[model samples]
Target chain A: MRAKTSAALNRSELEEELRAIGRRRYHDRHPFHELLHNGQLGRGQVQAWALNRFYYQRSIPKKDAALISRADSAELRRVWRQRLADHDGDEPGHGGIARWLNLCAAVGLERRKVESLDGLLPATRFAVDAYVHFVREKSLLEAVASSLTELFAPDIIADRMRGMLAHYDFVSNEAMAYFDRRLTEAPRDVDFALEWVLERAETVEQQESVLDALRFKCDVLWAQLDALYHAYVDPGHIPPGAFAPQDESTDRPRRYR
Target chain B: MRAKTSAALNRSELEEELRAIGRRRYHDRHPFHELLHNGQLGRGQVQAWALNRFYYQRSIPKKDAALISRADSAELRRVWRQRLADHDGDEPGHGGIARWLNLCAAVGLERRKVESLDGLLPATRFAVDAYVHFVREKSLLEAVASSLTELFAPDIIADRMRGMLAHYDFVSNEAMAYFDRRLTEAPRDVDFALEWVLERAETVEQQESVLDALRFKCDVLWAQLDALYHAYVDPGHIPPGAFAPQDESTDRPRRYR
Candidate 1:
């Protein structure tokens, strides 16, 4: 367990503590990610993942906007403005959410169904919404700290893109554009967020809150997978009204059928 | 799927729609509940349920208070005030939360661990926080409608009480005082809430929102059970830091041991 002590630490020590949290609790360590990164998950299981994960993708811009709204100065908000544009784009039919939709479509989920969020797991909605609310309600330092999950995201995105390309015959390099985009975008965002959090969290209490925020954010990402693993993976009992892929019983990709 | 139509119906039709939502979507129909109410769960599994559920039990008054804070009238606030008293009591250590802690204690969990929320599943925290946020942020009618899950609560509580007492020697009637109190309290609370919803949801949009609110509330309850079932039941992969039972490998009651 991470110590809950109130004793203050040096800047480098605090940064190490934050990095340690990502090492231990990031969603990349989750079993679902393990299966997802490798070829272990079936085609329908992959579709289930894409379908539910669209909720998180869709919420990113909204959360970024909330964080921008809470930012203290034009400098912070100006730095954060790239995230909104990065996810939302300069015009319609663009950006991260749309790219995610493309990935969902590539996986054989209907475009309309994915856009409508017709069969999202309730747990996904709750977790994503909680993250947005955390940014909106918590201190600005904590809000920036929460985005520190991005510190770990680029590595996972690389692993995911590499694994999916190699393992899934149906998945093409073009279809993995979202991860490719995030690979660059995430590092840029995290660098600013990490520096801001480290510079601003000067006191023991603020530092602990920063650590807790990242831990909370990690929990948010981790819980999303736990829901997926539970509902669509082992002993799979899809909750009433969640997406239930038709080809779950088969190992083959039945996208066209 | 529940229809999202805007065509207004008569009061009875609206009431029927709301009741139908409960019939189809309430957590009672969740498989985890089926296992628990049928006396199929092991003692450690039961402890997992109680430990995670303590979060939900602990949040009721906070949600109720949020609802009360939003009430437009003394009359409405006055009616909702009983929920606060019922869950929190006239004095410390006297009401529903206290009774739930008693139930947790009787289930062989240490009091400090449960109170500290040491091993809470992130999904549980997310789902419960979503419910509370719904009450705090949504329309008053929708908030009250969310509580309409109470319309179906009595039966489940009775089933839970009987099943736990019959199947688990570690459980006793006193351990279930929480449910017994809720049995009477829920009906009275729901009567007012149901009537308020029926009387106030005068427009088609309002009625539809009310129905959606109940559906949202059911999703909250069902998602909590999904987390429990995922973590403590079949192919269980307890999330890192979540409560893990020591005797999960055995079916025998090992509370004393």
Candidate 2:
């Protein structure tokens, strides 16, 4: 069992402790992450990563919608509604899912192929589904606390966006438009979420549950990278009956350059 | 998508295909499994595997109950109810779960600690929960088919029981009473389940779904092994917070000769 720090932390100290949890456990610390941010991964690996990650992105709004539906106050729901809008977008071909689709397209994955999730690892699906279930079933505070991983995301996104553009020839400014938007959006959302947690988690048990929720969310993110790293990055150990990179078509030129 | 065989297979062919699925995808093929059956793993690694696996064993009746609740026919429910009986038993401390607790006790794990599942891997929890959810939400045919892994369990149990007794001096005949029962119980259970699938999966799609359910069950079993391998077998690759072997205790002598 982890040692319990006294529940006497002031609001700022508690916030720092929560942010520290993110610093230590977030997916940005994972190895595949370094490969991704540094643009050291091959095109097919990137495509595989994006395709699998699309499952996570697509489920976010559904989880958030579940959170919204459970909220008693219209004001809380109104604040939560922005998350739905951000992911679902005003119309088709726009929101986070669409932006993720664009990343897949930029990496040369066919739209239909990406949409079908035909090639994703089973572990990836299980991990993402587990997250959706966690939010739907757990206390609302824990659900919101799970989203607090976003508090750490803006910095990682900055580092990743800069590193990818600087190191990779194939990546373009347009390819990473999703990260650009996330930089602004994540902090605003996370700020609200963090405050909601600090207010609701008055008891030590509630605070610990919120902390555990963040830890669980970190595991969800880290597990995805572990699957990708195991399957794509390290000698490409694809699990049985998951996506495989298509053979280069002889009809197409080897190099666009 | 896999090629669909014609819906009209003779009963023998259906059974063969089902057995073939087990041959290809069962946890016996997992690397940690080989270490287990070959006596290559250390005692701590062995203890960790047994501890995590208890979660799967404990969940079996609940998954079976979900299937029993969904069955419409008294005869079908009668067949499935046997599973509940087999696991839960007529009296306390007399069923499969109690048998599993005995196995854990033999491994030097405390009964309360094992039952608390405090030492379990997060992946183990998610994978088993996913199996329960799959049985509850999927078609009843798929739910019944998922238990079809029992068809292959008798052989694996034979191999595991023999290997553990031969390899580990700490394990005794009394400790492994769980397998003696499973060796008989599994075949009886599998025989009924195989007949159930053969009788019910009348369409190609239904057959395919049944096949897929077995595959999913295989993945669930395999994923638990994967978590064990990654955390215990692999050097320094433990997930953020999972079971850790206690530092070699000076007070207690090593159990193995």
Candidate 3:
């Protein structure tokens, strides 16, 4: 863990460690996900997940901008800068954020309130802010390492797209534009990060750190699900000042948004 | 989330946001944590946690050294340099890492194997490296901001100490010395980081970034717990190539080292 006591691991070994971490710990394996994809959650639970997740969606542009600000080279900045455009776009009502907002609207959350983050869970804020901070405050290698969680995102999004669209009437192919774009965009971003981590993390300590960075990023994603599960699933323990479920009177789970 | 549309918030508001993030998103809220603190985890689960956490304890010196390497001023370096000493001491078996190894030994893991990090989870590796890289790559302000997670650590450590000592047969007063030292050491570090962050982050963007940095750090800690919980607690889904339990054939769990 420290002192660089051993010889450097080859890139393949480091990659294997990272892939193993993802396979074992990705949120796709989380029980909340099992509940989600299997169509076991109610509408209100689904609504709560979407509302809280909006905080994450809204944060991507800030994270991308921070990465751009930190990169020293023009080429690096130029290649990476596309992320900001991909999330924010040239005009209002376009791109990923807009699509996320459309999803929120489809689920019955008001855009202004969502923008204000008035009902956003503290867990959502913490998780999203962590990501933006991870991009801004880690080394370029580490920052890219953190983004490696994207390697697994396409599968999760596809699961989500298939599950939500099929199970929830509120979900539509149009509302899933955010995920559709991500299916394309995340792969490109991940390819860059994977190559960057492989090439730059040359020493044993550096390679271990890079592998760990991806795991840390996975935790970031997984923790969000834990929060959602705690707040909206079986336990339903909502924290103070988080978004409240609209229907709380019944012993049985209510229909979710 | 982008463009910094509003003027800077008052410092109190910024502080509130930071505190709120911690209150809501810190690992103290994770259920696996609740289980650990309540002494509900089996010995094997506890062993797995201690073994993996050794990786975190081992990385502190490297993170401190990285912070020292990135700072510009003698004053900043002088203040931060104590961290390396606190963790490394004058020789082998002298400092925080040594104390942590002692704790590992007390908990029944071999000090040598723990140091080897041969059985560490990929998640554990990822979270620890993120902290080290955060120190090495981020702006001085953001680096300090990331360390502010220490501000919340004392309470959690105190809880763990009380719970583990009271509940677990193998844990003892000597084993808790690492956390005891942290109870003192963390305060000094947190004071510097909190004061530095409050004083230096002048713009709204800077302050928000600082706040987000702390939140990012909380996620890092929380993510580690998520990994621990998934591997050892309720789902008990250990990742491939991670440390395995000593006994798996019976319905009942067994004592582990």
Candidate 4:
């Protein structure tokens, strides 16, 4: 844990501390990622990941909209508005969520099932909704700081794109389009957010909230994977009403294999 | 999944459906509970459960307060006020939270650490906070329906009390007082809330929402155990900065035994 210091950190010091949290707490460090990246995950496992992840992907525009709704200045709103357009797109069946659904479809899930989110792990909904609620209700600076997870996202996205392509025949260039787009989109978004947070978080307590906000976001991401690993990986016992792999028995016998 | 029926059911049918949800989805059925009630967990695991559960215990009054804030009638507010009193007590160190702290003390956790919630699992915070937000934000019928899980609580509390007292040497009657108290409190609370829900949820859509709300609350409880089971039980990898057992190396090596 970063020592709970009362003193305010300098620009670089705060940035370093944020990066350290990413190194330690980001979901990229989660073991499920190792399984996912290395292609040790079965096809159904990958499908479950995509299907559940689609909830997070789909919530981006909503979360961004919530943040935009809370933005005080036109410049801040203007900067954040790009997120909505990027995620929701200018026209029907475009943008990140559409691309994500396409990815889910490529993984063999039906379009309607993915859209309805009928099969989602309730834990996934809880975590993602918590993120959106955090942005909408917390102080705007803390809201902006929550998005700093994007500062670390590009690397994980790149690693995911490379790993999925090499190990899984089911994954294709088109299927990985969501991450490909994020590679460019995330950096642009993070640059403005990081600068805004660094400039605005002037006091020690504000700086700590900034750091804690990022930590909360990391937990949001990491907890999703933990749920996946528990339900679909080791000791797999998919919760009642969650997505069970089609080929597997729906009984979800609770034994560690 | 309770087949999503569009047709409104009679009172008895709705009640039966609600009870069926509890049968299938209550956190009491979670494996972590089986482990807990059966005394399969180590002391550190038990401590982790209490420390994490304390977050949920502390939030009950806030949730009731939110519900009361939204209530349109004096009777509703007056009835809900009792929950606040039960949890928060008349003064400092007097309510259910204080009693919970004593339980935590019985399990050997520090009062300061428990109060600060410094050692809490981030997932625990996320799940608990989601429940509070649901009550604050969702339609009042849904909020009232969410408490219907209390309909199932007395049995679980009874089992928990019996099992903990019989299985764990560290436990005492006084330590179990919170559950002992909850057994009476939950049934009384559920009686009023369930009757209110049965009366208010008049439309088919609203009835469906009531069932869904209970499902959501069960997920809230079950997700907490999922976090605990993942971090303290199988394939344990305590996330960075969460409470790690003192006897265990803080490194929290990821391999499952």
Candidate 5:
């Protein structure tokens, strides 16, 4: 029985170790990131990625608000409110979501079409919805731990920003502006979230839940890219209702109006 | 406005059109069916498909129960109750879900692992959950209409059962018993559901809503296969936490037990 008790502590250590698993294995290191940053992807691929990824950006604030509403403590809610502002911003034509729209436009997707998410893959929608549902249903510690993926995001954003400006002809400092803010925002966000997990995950079970949350979040991120790579990169088996890449030489037909 | 209005149809015609949609687009024609029936899929792929698809079958009774609970009329509830019985069975080890477990055991998966859904794709869970949510939230008429996918299921089951026993060396009549029962159960349920939709969808708006329900049901079915194809059949881009196919020839040393 004492050995079993010691095993429980070992399990908590194992759970913290699994949280570190996300830092190494998540898509922050995927080859597509390298291509996306280096501007090596064709305009069509870039358009596809941005259009598909817009769904993720659009959902973040909604899920964050969901988490905010579920928080029982004022301090927790107060800490969570920053995500809402970061995504929605204080004024029109600002915030993370708008910045994502600018990225979409820069990549050549029509603003209306991008906003509609008509062209986004169903898998992307499913993955994002799964994330939202996880936040709503899982324990608050796990919900907060899921966002710990942000702990690793700042480094990727730095790589992406430098790579995009150097490689892509269409990219401008203004159009690639989302990453610039995230460079600072992500670290601040990550610090608070990491501290929250380390401080609050006091039990073996809580530690396991937090670890599972990060793993779930990693799956969420990886599934999005898997859909993108499958649809746009490899066999390119585009499912029905997903976004179709526009012909490089052509534009939206006038008759669509 | 007049051109848009012209597409509206009377109730009988709308019911026929909705059934026609099921006839044309259901999973009966999916290549995976051909593969499964012909015994062409390798054992691992077959195991992967069954493990993943169990998530769908397991959720059916829950969704049916939700629909049954939402139903206002006794006659409607009585008709819907058959689906619950079909899936859940009169006792343990007798119903569709149990029969599905038998199939899993025949394929060599441990019953506990299969039950836990440890290996199922994340997208499969989301798609199944989406169906349950649709039934819970939509109008009763639409929920009944969604089950009209069963309108197409009987024919597929006939082909599947005959083909599996004829072609698959590993399969037995006992192993494929789930399909045998579904042959009778699906048609009976579908006929009642079709009549229910036809009788209730009197308004043009109601008719359109029923059609939309069938479309949504089709999406649910198609999305499940899409996830399967993406994960197991294509390049096998298995998402994190999903079941990974094991090598049959080399049994790994058991670490968990």
Candidate 6:
């Protein structure tokens, strides 16, 4: 029976703020996603997305592993350990990263080209690196709170899975198995993180910091799409030494071993 | 003396490589500066430049202090201590940073606004933070070598001092005093660092590291101007929550207390 006060937000109030953040700031709201989902994007554009996203996908396990290393509680470790397992899997040729590479191959990018990362946009690298560094450098609560973007993730993943499959013939059910898994994993992860954050963020200052970390994560995600839209969409201001799509056509689906 | 192979560059060759890096990569060559120095930029652009460059100027004392804290030799400390004095000065009103704030005031930006840094572009902050991190984290010779951007600085400063004053009525000989001082200070500082680096970068690996450091520092500077150019000059995409110039006209010059 808690009443909301200016001193601090009750759980529901904090939840509302977090939801409002996702509503306003999520990459799901980015025009790139709108174009991406509706099949309006070129094949080269799709390939560019797959290629750049592989960097984020590959880095997730490392980010999760960094978080796990700093976890003081076994309960926290138990919940977070699943992130590493989900991302890294038990052995080689498995897990989300491998599936992402498969998507890259399906989208017609050479697997080695994505993995080498020599063609990454500086904006992509900086935005992603800033996230990893934020998690490593900020307080544990802030680190854990940053992942609350997952609170908004299930919807984006669903939209992406549905829209990408519908719009792009090059995309297939197999290329999207990654999202199917995320649909389940994200909700569970978000629930655990949400409950953990709500319980721990008792003070108004802590609540604000938690909220700000979520907003920061949203900016990180949004900036990636902004870079993509700028480079691939209007104005096409491709910086020097980033991956250049061969031509302005949709890539045919290809299988890679 | 070691013959020039894949292995080692002799002193003069290393100097040439460092200078060559400056020739190719310095921010002086950035299109932003081309517009800035040619008087092609509007007053808003000049004001934006002053506001952002303040972040770099104020950070100098802290950067120099970080390097000094790591220096192993008394001679190094004595020379480096002068950098501290030059930026921070003996008292509050005297140093390079204070002069920079005065310039900011002269350019019609609120000095308080520049000092608060709430108006800074994300790109400016990240680039400068990366430099501070590099100096704090890298080897001493590499840290010292990174400042070797100063080796190229005197020329840029002289050109800037002449060009800015020649072009902008708001800019005067007194307002130009900081660059004048830097013209004298940079060469002396660079000569000390260059000799220290050449004499001590005894291995090819160390030499390469020093060269890479100088290159990294160049990137730091070039990236800042790229942000300014992108936001102020060309596509004019100012990021959300950065300082927005009130009007396109050059600000009427004003002096500060």
In order, the interface RMSDs are 0.9, 2.2, 6.2, 1.0, 2.4, 3.3
lDDT of 1 by residue, B1-257 (tens): 44557468899998888888888999989889889988888778898999999999899999999999999899899999999999999998899999999999998999999999998999999999999999999999999999998988988989888888888888999999999999999999999999999999998789888988999999999999988887888667777778877674674433321
- Tens-digit per-residue lDDT, B102-196, candidate 4: 99999988989999999799889888999999998899999999999999999899999999999998899999989988988999999999999
lDDT of 5 by residue, A136-218 (tens): 88898889999988867877888888888888888889988998999889988887887777878776677667777887788
By lDDT, highest first, what's the ranking? 4, 1, 2, 6, 5, 3
lDDT of each: 0.88, 0.82, 0.77, 0.89, 0.78, 0.80
Candidate 3 achieves a global lDDT of 0.77
Pairs of colliding residues, candidate 2:
A119-A243
DockQ of each: 0.81, 0.39, 0.10, 0.77, 0.42, 0.20
TM-score result, candidate 6:
0.84
Task: Looking at model 2, give its docking quality level.
Answer: acceptable
lDDT of 6 by residue, A1-257 (tens): 13335689899998898888888777788778999988898887788788878888888877887888898999998899999889887998788888888888888888888899866766665567677877888888999999999988887888888898988888889988888888899999999999999999999888888987887787777667766766676556455445677664444422110
TM-score of 1: 0.94
* Per-residue lDDT of candidate 5, residues B1-257 (tens digit): 12324556666677678767876668776666777888777677778878888999999999999998997889888878888888898998889999999998887788999998886777777778878878888898888889888878877888888887887666788988998888888888878888878888876677778887887787677767766666677656676556777766676521111
Q: lDDT tens digits, residues A31-94, model 4?
A: 9999999999987899899999999998988888998888779999999999999999999899
Query: By DockQ, who's the top model here?
Result: 1
Q: Model 4's CAPRI class?
A: medium
The Cα error of candidate 4 at residue A108, in Å, is 0.5
Best by TM-score: 4
- Which prediction has more favorable TM-score, 1 or 4? 4
Model 4 chain B poorest 10 in a row by lDDT? B248-257
lDDT for model 5 comes to 0.78
Candidate 3 clashes between residue pairs 3 or more apart in a chain or in different chains: A42-A256, A43-A255, A43-A256, A43-A257, A44-A255, A44-A256, A44-A257, A130-B216, A212-B126
DockQ of 2: 0.39
Pick the winner on DockQ between candidates 5 and 6: 5
Pairwise TM-score winner, candidates 1 and 6: 1
What TM-score, to 2 decimal places, does chain A of model 3 have? 0.92
Candidate 2 vs candidate 3: the lDDT winner is 2
Model 1 segments more than 4 A misplaced: A1-6, A248-257, B1-6, B248-257
Between candidates 1 and 4, the lDDT winner = 4
If chain B of candidate 2 is superposed on the true chain B, what is its TM-score? 0.92
